[model samples]
Each structure stands twice: as structure tokens, then as C-alpha cells.
Target: MTISTTSTIAADAADAMPPLYGLKVLDFTRVLAGPFCTAMLADAGAEVIKVEPFEGDDYRQMGLQVDGHSANFAFVNRGKRSVRLNLKQAGARDVIARLAGWADVVIENFKPGVADRLGIGYGALSALNPGLVYCSISGFGQSGPWAEQPAYDTVIQALSGLMDVTGDPAGAPTLVGESVADVAAGMFASWGVMAALWQRERTGRGRYLDVAMYDCLLSMMPTLVSRVMAGAPATRQGNRHANSAPFGAFHAADGLFVLAVANNRLFAKLAEVLGQPALASAPEFATNQDRKRQEAALARLIEDWASALPVQEAVRRLTEAGVPAAPVLSVAATVASDNAQARGLVVRQRPASGPAMCHVEQPVRFDAMPRGQTSAAPALGADTLAVLEALGFDAGAVNAMQQQGVI
Candidate 1:
């Protein structure tokens, strides 16, 4: 089956130019980390050609589906084209080599040595295209004692000491709600790729990036890591801040709210907001360090006042008193909030063959360039023929390859 190239550029030509408008990315990523990295590039206007296996990305079948397309897949794979190639076949290497030659950057999250075994490792691709900024995302990086050990987000979270400091002090270790390790690795990989691209412009050469989920998660916990390194045992504070007093979730009349009394000033304001201004001057709460010593007492005092008021009212009173406070909003409430709408946080994109879908826009913004339009994640092999044609393959050749099950 042949697919048209009409959906290649989702954003209109008249829209503001994207930062990576002329950039070309060859994406051999499957799941969250690699796809998310490429998604950022694609959102910035890079032409990302996602090379998938013949059966498609495993993520496409792993989550809630809209018209048979996975919503999770859509969230991370938007604004990119999909080209399916059976890399196990002998004929597939040529296609990958051609794409590598055409690309400015290539990203993959294959297990260590898998790409090399397939003859498409950074060494091979950089040889074919000397200026390629290749990024390899993995569980434990290219060389490590645990490099060969298989890992998922939870595994990294466990090993990175993130889970150790996540839950209530008396509770079992808790996994964060989202895939923090995977997302962090993806974010860091994008940073590495961008830095490499910038460096390449000056040095006239490419570089390889080794981004590990474990390392990225470990890097994310600077405070916790430093504390542990300094001989402090890891402590789980749950919703409480490690070094701050009365800085955590508190129950209100209607629901939960969070307030941060980061300094003495904020604590004083919080005390005033709770209608007990004298508490700010109390010997136990006079200073942040003293308040930290009596955090349970402070929390009780604050909660006593907060529990009488609804979350919004408590938040408003705290705000008026110059204290930082906000209600705890669920995901649904957050997405529908006025702030979310005003900031264009949610976007709509239509896939080539499916109904329109909503996505969260990339967070970064450029003053000179308006946000680009969104595109739905492509169907498997949606751009196989088009990508092959772009690689100088004729329709007859593509047909022959298809007949041979190479794509």
C-alpha cells in the first residue's frame, strides 16, 4: 500500500518559522524516552522521520486507543512522519544508511550493542554522515556495570534513590505517578542533541551522546543525592519539603491545598493569613529554623485555620497576605483551567486518517517564532513509500521491497 506525502507538514507555510525548520532527524526510537526527545525536535520544526519496525512501535498497542491509535503514542510521537522498515531484513540497512546520510541528527534507544549488531550504530552512521549528531538513550549508558541489565522507568527510579525519598516516612517506597526517569532521560537527550548540534556548527564535526535513564534520574535529585553523599540517610517526607516548615499539603474545608513558607517572611504572612499573626512572633515559630523544629505544631496551627475555609478561599487569603499558596488540582481541573487555556497549553492535531485529538503543547516558546501547529502521530508505514522516494527509490523498487517484506 502506498501513502501520500500531503500530511508531511502539519503547520501552514505562512506560520512563523520554527527554530529547527531546516533540521532533519532520523528517529529510530520506539517508546517514551526516544520518541519524546524526537517529539521535542519535531515540535521545534525539525523534519523527524520516525523509522519503526514492520509491526509498529510497541507503545501503539499499549494504551488507550482512538481509532486504533494509542493516545500515549500520540502524545509523544506527534509532529513526525512514520516510516516502517523491517531492519532484520538484509535490504533494510541501505534505507537506514540513506536516511542517516540525509539527516542532521539521529536518535535511538536500543539496548546496548543492538544498533551495532544491526550495522547502524553511531560509528556506522557517523561514518556515512560525518556531521550526524547521534544520540543513544539507554537504561544505564554505553559502558557501565549495569549497562547490559534491562531496566524500565520504575527500575531506574528504584536504583536512582528517587523512590527512597518519595513517600511518607513510614510508608513503603512509592513510585512517582508518571515515568520520571524516562521523561528525564528524554529531556536530557534533547539537551545533549541540541548542544551537540551547536558544537558541530563550530567544530564542523559531529558527536555522540550517551544518555542513560538511570543517570538522568540520579542527576535530577541533586538535593537528595547531596544529602546522602554528605552522610545523611535518605528520608521520605511525602508532601512536605525537606528543609522548610509548614510547607506541604494541608486539608481545607472543601479539599487539599499546598502552601510554601519558604522563609521567615512567608511564614509570618502565612501566620497572618491564618488569623494568628502573634504566632509569627511566638518563640517556637520566630525563625524558619525554629519553625522547622516545630513543624508538626506549625502544621497543626495552619491546618486548624485552613480546615475551616474552602481551598480557594484559603488560597486567596494566603495570596492576599503575601504567602504562596494554591489548591491541589487534579489533572482534569488543570487541563480545563483558565490559565491552561490562556497559555495554549493544550493543542489540537488531526492525524492523516483519524479524528482530531488534543495534546499538550511543547512548553518552550520563542519570542520571534509563534508556536507551530500540531500533527497527529502517523499510522505505521504511513510514510514508507514517500520516505523511500525521498531516498531516491522508485515506485517499482519500493514495490519490490514490499514484496520481499523488507518494509
Candidate 2:
């Protein structure tokens, strides 16, 4: 399901119709990375039971509230059940143990060894349910030199050389605009979970996944790693790439547009489109390597030429000349773009107590042959009673569990 996972997977529900339907996943993750990964499984139709703590996921309090839940929380947790449980309490462990027995997968994002301390670590639970695809996500891996240190997205970025390669030539090194490290790790974890689940069907065994944000970030550092390995100088180019010249943003009369004259052919096309065909074969700009040697002069020429043309016309000319160009669009612009609307990216969701929610639809669309009705995110504790009953907890046990600070 991911771009990187190298495994043979069967065409399960996740790959066919509602991909994750009929599969029960216990999600013990919070914040960006873990939630984002499980959210992917949920979007594909997994019955994700988001097991929250007694105090609830911290993101529930972030952003604008929608019917007692934050929009931030609702966006990622839009199709999962929430059951509150206090894991520190003895009563809660029994409930979690029961859920583990019932669940097909378990995802957690607590700090290193926190789950072990709580007795829900893979070693303990795998003994109870060998078929569970247990996954743990953290800033660092469960074991290593820096496993126990506190980490945030920025810390990982700084430590992994991502930040060092992500800024303007002379600008301060910037963290990625979004939590890319967390997102990458979550995505990787999700891929691992699905692979493990599919493998379990054939092997009748589950796998434990250990995805660390720092390691994920490091894995994504292609250009930076290459340069470091080769001992090449890495400049701080805010919007430019060290791999190629004329591959950055430029301002047109109307707005900003990005262009990537990546190779010699595109560079020639760019020069001719700009009515400077003579520059196409000029000694200082003939080859990509030569252009990089004279990047300052080349950039100045592009800026001067781009300044006189309107954004749309400039983009049109470049496009017509076999070059890539596009306006830098904001969220509003993207939502309103003709291409996005045509692709059916804007989906409508109507929660009973609130206004209709217009959110982005699932990015993974089947081949128009999948079947089944979609499921929305569950209300807080909406399925608690049903889940308890299914677990063979009679009425009295349910009541007793609730009274003992467990759901």
C-alpha cells in the first residue's frame, strides 16, 4: 500500500473493496504520525477502535471544536470508535487485554518501553495473541543509543540532516512546513502493519513493527545523504535544489511559479521560450554541469525574464514549449482548482449535530469495481456497550469495569 514496502501482499479488502473492513484494529496512537497511519487504514475501511486514555487524546483539545471534539481530531479520526480506558489502573489492563485478544492489530505511539512498563508491549501481548500485527511508533526505536531521549519533529529533523538541506541558500535551516518525519514514520508503520496482516493469512503468525521517526527521516534524506557520502558541499538554498540549476521558484507579474529546467533539453526549451535561443548553446550554459558552475548568472537571467511576464502567460509559454511550470497555489486555490474538483477530491460528510463536513476524500481510489457502504467515524464510546458484549463481558462485568475507571 506504500511506495517503499517491498513485500508480496494478497488482495485483501484494503487492496480491493473497503480494504480494512471486517478487520479490527486497536489504535493506541496519538498526534500526527501514528494517527495519520491508522487513519489511512480506517479510510480504506478498517474497523479501527481508537483506544484513548481517561484524559483523551491530546489532539482532542486542539483546533476549533466541533460537537465537543476538535476539528483537528475529527479530521484524522473521522471513521473510528473511541473507547476511553485508564491503562495505569489495574481494571483498564484487563479491558485492554480483552481488546487485544479481540483485535487483529494493535498500534501504539507511546515513548520507548512505556508499553512494556504498562504490560502491553509486544512481548507480553504476542504471547496472548500470536496473530496480532503489533506496531510501535516512537521518535527513536525501542532500542538504540538515543531511544529514551525526548524528541519532537524538529529534533528529528535537525538530527537527521533534513533541516540542514531544507532552506534557502543563505536562509536559516527550516523544519519542514508539516510534520513530515511523523507522517513518514506513520506511513511506513501502516505499510508494515498491512504486510504483516496479509502475511498472517498464509503463515498464521503476526509481526512486530518498530518504526522510529528519526530513522524514517534519515531514510528520506536522499540528496543530503548522497552529498554527505561524497563529501560534497551542501549549500542552504531556500527554494532551490543543489542537484539542478534553474529548478526553483520565480516571481511572475501576477504570482509565483515554479520551474524545473532539469536537463539540457529542458534548459534549451526554456531559453528558446524566453526568446533567448542564443543562450541555449552558449558556452557558460551549454551543459547542466556548466550551468551549475555559472548558476548565479543563469538565475539572474531567469528572474529578469520572468519579471516581465504575467504568471499565467509565462506558465502557458513554458508549458507549450515542453517545460514544466505551475503557479504556487494556496489551500483555497487548490480546493477551488478545476483539476482537483474534477478528480473528486472534495468529499462531503454530514455529522448529525454539526454542519456538513467538507473534507478531502480518500486519496486511494479503487478501480470503480469495489463494493460496500462507507462507515463514518464513531462517536465517543458509541460502541463501548457493543464491544463489551462481544468480548463476553456480561452486564455486571461491564458495569464493574466502568466503575473501576475502565471502559
Candidate 3:
């Protein structure tokens, strides 16, 4: 749905600056993780300058393209200005140094040593701007035995034990439906940047943040960590939770819906909705532990009752009874749901050319700050001349650098 730009709320929001207004971000990330981090900063009203190679970020050419624009690129790079400069070119180093000096935060996702080689490493930039918060997003981390090894989202998932516990118990390990590793790392990186920024405000010194995809994903899965730490091996349990019974997908007449009966109260509610109130008091199903021990039997009972009803109808009854339940929805369905609409989860931005684009807005709400609106992702180098001129480079100087194949 289109956002109502003329609404009083919209007009008021437009007049108010966001929380990160005036924050300067130099984004040297490509693909998902780094771009995702910077995208959040941009959403908070940071002025993000996305640095790219002459060919632009790899995401521009990596995913589904609509009339030559990469939807994935646009999804993550919204509200950022694009500036193309060849990092390998010596002349580009001068521009990067200036950009780093201008930035309050810098994010890079290159391999650990690549930024150092390019002269945009934390040591170099922080020397120029001691108050700069520098964040490096990587698969393993900035340093470790596996630091130099190349890592993709899938690699991190597998290496981080995420794939090991994601699929059906009887089936082979499976990757998650989306790039959870990249997204987790990006989220942590953004958090790290903000934390560093706050610390800088107190200490009058910036900090270096090393965010690893593996570490972040591992941190996100607290249950898995707790189980392993307790000497219990984490295993795939299909759609069921390892610790809780009646807390996973159940079959309905039309399809699968999920239910969560975490405690005895919820279990009683679920039993009541299932037309089996006595089941909640059964010796084998009384406590959460006892119910988990009979999880398969519990599942059969749930399926038997649910199988007669449609998915949504089953969910509605369970929900109305105070048991957490919901139909399994596709990504598009979730995005377009009434709840999502009410929360303004998806925002529409009209590009200068082509159809309007939809982006998932940053989820947090701040009472004093306005919801952020975004410009479409920039064309490659669209802001280079303007940005350079703003940096005090004359048009002639910028043109000369361009002619030298530096930008």
C-alpha cells in the first residue's frame, strides 16, 4: 500500500528530523551485510555515503533486476548517496581519506586485511578522526584462524552450526530460507556502531568494532547455546522446539499452522480449544516437561483436532482461546498483512524513473522522532561530482581524477 504523503501525521513527521540526523556514515560495504548495516543508519537519518568500485556494489548485478535495477541492491541501499571510486587507484586513496576524515562512522565488510591494504583501515582513519567509530563486518572476524578464509552466507550458516539444527530431524541439514547469517551480522554491526558512538560521547574516543557473522548468529540462538552449554547436543527437531511441546507447526485441513503452548496455562487453553480439556490434566501432559516427554503423542492429538479445520479457522479458535496460534504465511503475505500495514512495516518510494519501490522500514518506533522516509537507491556515481565538490574538490579537479580512471 502507498504511504499517504499528504496526511497530517506524514506532514508532521516530514518536518521533524530523525534520531540520527546529521550523523555522517561512510559505507564501504558491498552485498548484504554491510549494506544492511548502513541502511539502518540511513533510516535513522544518517547521511550515508556509499563508496563503490567503478562497477558499483556487487549486489547491483547479483540479484533480480527490474529494467536493469537490482531489487536487492535497492532494498538495502535506500537513502544513501553513491560515490564510485576505484580503491585500487592511488588517486582514489586521497578521496577515501577525505571521506573517512569526514565520517563519524565507517563500515567495511572486506576481508580482514583488504581495508588495511586500501588505506581505509581503522588505524589510518581513526588517526585522522580520532572520534570515528569504525566497524568491520566479516564472516569469521577481524582476526582468528579462519579469518582469511572466504565466507558466504551459506558458509557461515554451516560453520556456525545453524544448518546443523535447522531442518527436519530425519532429513539432511538444510540452510534457512533467508540469509540469516548476513542479516544477524549486519544487525550486530549496527548495534555495535551505536554503542561505540555512545561510548565515544562519554570517553571522547571512538572504538573499533569487530562483528563476526558466526558469532552474531550463535548469539541469536540462545536456546541452542544453552542446550550445548548444558552438555546437551543441539539437534534438528523439524518444526518443533527442542524444549517446548505444542510449540511448533501443526497440520490443519488445508495446511500447517503454528501454535505455542509454553506453560500449563497455555496448555490448558490449547486443550480447551481442542475440545479436550481433560488432556491438560492428564499425568503425561500436565507439566511442560511431562508434555515435552510425550511430544509426539501431543502432536498427534493436536493434528487430529486441527485436521478437521482449515488452517486459519484452527488458528483463530486457538488464538481466541488464548493459545498463541497463527497460520504459516508466505513472505509476501506477511508483508501485506493488516498488522503490517498498521505498523507501517513496508514503505513505498518512487524512483526518479520506473515504478515505485517498496522497502521494509526499520522496525523500531521512537515517540520523539519521526518515521524515516527514503529516497530511491542512487544511480552509480550519481552523487560523485556533487559529493566531491562538497568536499572542496573543484569540478576541474574531479574531472581530472575521473579522466585518470580513479573515479
Candidate 4:
């Protein structure tokens, strides 16, 4: 089972040197939030070891499959190694302890008390390696009234009042199409890890991180919450901005488009683009306050003009007129658009066992360089033996652990 270090593939010289190169992360996480956090670190060139149960991460079977691997899993797991271990097995504790000693960071998303019961909690591991940055992502943080209550994205969104301000004004509350809360928590957790690492460099000490989906989502509700704090009622305005006029979707001859005529200058440009330049000088629509009061009438006039033109023509005319506008696009259309390709926003990779796959590239750049090429997600336990050997385990020991179902 042991793999010789000499046989390990060396990194390509042509690839850009990643910012997190040589950082080692032990990822004791699965599903969305924790996986996403570690994935970002891995994308930055950390050597992330994803430790999973023998049956593999549940996300592996939750979404669309490509050659028997989940596309969802692939999206968040690329650029990492996988090591299978049954933490319930007595022998697995030793394996986890060893990996803990080697890792600079350990991130887990287990519900409260689970990690402690499994003996891989912060206290146990931090005792073994005090400089190890341990991050725990949970539904409601490590200590709270709802800490033990299970939660998913929708639940967090609803509880955080995000749903209350989403969707059409007259419609039932709607959950965001994507898992915003989970992704936010993941992003915050990654930021926390980096901050902790930076501080450790100065003080020679590691810290524990408690990231909560509820807290993250609530933090993102400043606009709505702040309004309420100022004694304003919270209400949904559909696609419209609460304080802006003509700042939402409109229909064209062929499809839907959006505009953001936030300032008088932009509103004037929009009026000129609509062939009603005099409307800009009209007292009823001359100022932002005036437009806000007559938004419905103004939107109707713009829509009447746009409804005569195709979405593309409408968008082109608006752009040329110096007004910000865009046609609403489907997910497929977005990925295929020239703008996406020009920005290098999508990446294509061919896995050893699956068809070529396309993924959204990390939306970050360093030194004017986009993220480096990423490897395909690993198959379950694909690098167990190699990782163990890299950890100094010999062939016989690896074989014994495997036979005992500890890895």
C-alpha cells in the first residue's frame, strides 16, 4: 500500500507558484461548507488531505454524476487528496492524531459534540499540536441555544431574515436558488483560517475558529437589518433596490433585461436611449427623489421603448448611451458567453475516469495571474496509501491498517 516518495509526481514548473504552497491542511469535513473552505485553500496550493468515512463523503451521491462521481462533489473537492478512515474504529484515532501532527490547519463541520465524541475534537488534537489552527463550522456556532439543532441552507436563510426580503413583494418567501448561507460560512471560515495563520506567524500560537451559517448569513443582511434598526419596516421589493428608481428588470421584445439608473446622469442617459430625452427634464422625473416617486410611470415608459427592441439591441443601445444594463441569462448561456471566456471564468479539466468537465474558476487573482490549473477531484480513498507513506508509514503498516478497516 505504501508509495515511494521518489515515484510521486512533482509539480509542473510552468504553473504559477501558488500563494499557499507548502501549507498542509487536514480536512475532516464533508458536504458543502467545510469542503468549500478547504477547497479554496487547496485551490491556493495548500496540500489538503480530505479525510472521509469508508463509505465516502455523502455529497458524492447527492447530485448529478459523471462517470459515477458527483459533479457537486467535484466542484468543491478539486485539488485535494482523499484519505478514508473510520474514526469510530479504535485504530483510526492514531491515524487522525498522526495527520493532525502534520497539518497546519484542521477544519471540520461536524454537528456539535460529534467531533468530541469521536476523539478528534479541538482539545484532543490541539494538545497534540498546539500550533494547529482548528476551525469548526456549525449551524449556530459552538455555543448557543440552537447550537445542537440541525440546519440546512434554507433553514439558515429563513432564520436570518434573508428570505423575508427576497422574491416578489406579494409572493411567499423564497429561498435563494443557491446555498448562500453555506457558501458564506465557507468563505468566512477560509478567511478565519488565513487570519489565524497570519497571527500564528507573529505570536507562535494557533487559535480555534467557530463559524456559524446563521451568523454568516445574518452578517450579510446589513441593508435590510440596518433599515429596520433605523425604525423602517422590512419589506421585499422584488428585484428593485429599496432606495433606487428604475433599478430592476424590464422586458424586451425577446427577453428580460435589467438596468441600474442610479444617478440623475444615468437616468438622463436612459431617457436619451429611449428616444425621450425630454423626459429627463420633466419635473416629475428630473431628480432622483422625483423619479423614486414616479418609478412605476418611468419604468412603464422605458419598458414601452424596450418592448419594441430585442434584448440584445436594447442592451447595446443602453450601453452606448452610458447607462448600465444587461440581459438576464440562463446558467448555460452564461457559461458559454464570450465575456465568460474572455475573463477566464470557466475552467475545463478531464479526469482520469470521467468525461471532460467544466467548472467555474475561483474568482480571485494574484499578481495579475488567475488561479493555476487544478487537478480533478480524487476518487474515494484514492491517495490513502500514498498519503500514509508520505506521513512515514511503511508498506506493512499501511497494509495492516487497511486490513483492520482503520483506513
Which ten contiguous residues of candidate 1 have the minimum total lDDT? 1-10
Q: What does candidate 4's lDDT look like per residue over 222-262, in tens digits?
A: 98889999999889999888888989999999999999988
lDDT, candidate 3, 1-407, per-residue tens:
11111111222554465777778889999999999999888887778888999988999998888888888888898888888888888888778778877889999999999999988899999999899999999999988899889999999999889899989999999999999999999999999999999999899999999999988998999988899999999999999988889789989999999998889999988888878889988998878899999999999999999888999899899888988889999998999899989888888777767556778867888666656366778889888887887787887888889899998
Q: How many pairs in model 2 have backbone atoms within 3 A of each other, for residues 3 or more apart or on separate chains, i.e. clashes?
A: 12
Q: Whole-model lDDT, candidate 1?
A: 0.86
RMSD of each: 2.5, 4.8, 4.0, 2.6
TM match of model 4 to true structure: 0.95
Candidate lDDT (C-alpha), each: 0.86, 0.78, 0.86, 0.86
TM-score of 2: 0.90
TM-score of each: 0.95, 0.90, 0.94, 0.95
Assess candidate 2 and give its lDDT.
0.78
- Per-residue alpha-carbon lDDT of model 2 for 20-139, expressed as tens digits? 656778888887788888877776767777877777888878777766757766667666777777788888777778888878999999998899998889998888899999999999
Please estimate how well model 4 matches the true structure, expressed as its whole-model Cα lDDT: 0.86
Of 1 and 3, the candidate ranking higher by TM-score: 1
How badly does each model clash, as a count of residue pairs?
Answer: 0, 12, 0, 0
User: Is candidate 1 or 2 superior in lDDT?
Assistant: 1
Candidate 2 wrongly placed segments (more than 4 Å) = 1-16, 64-68, 354-362, 369-376
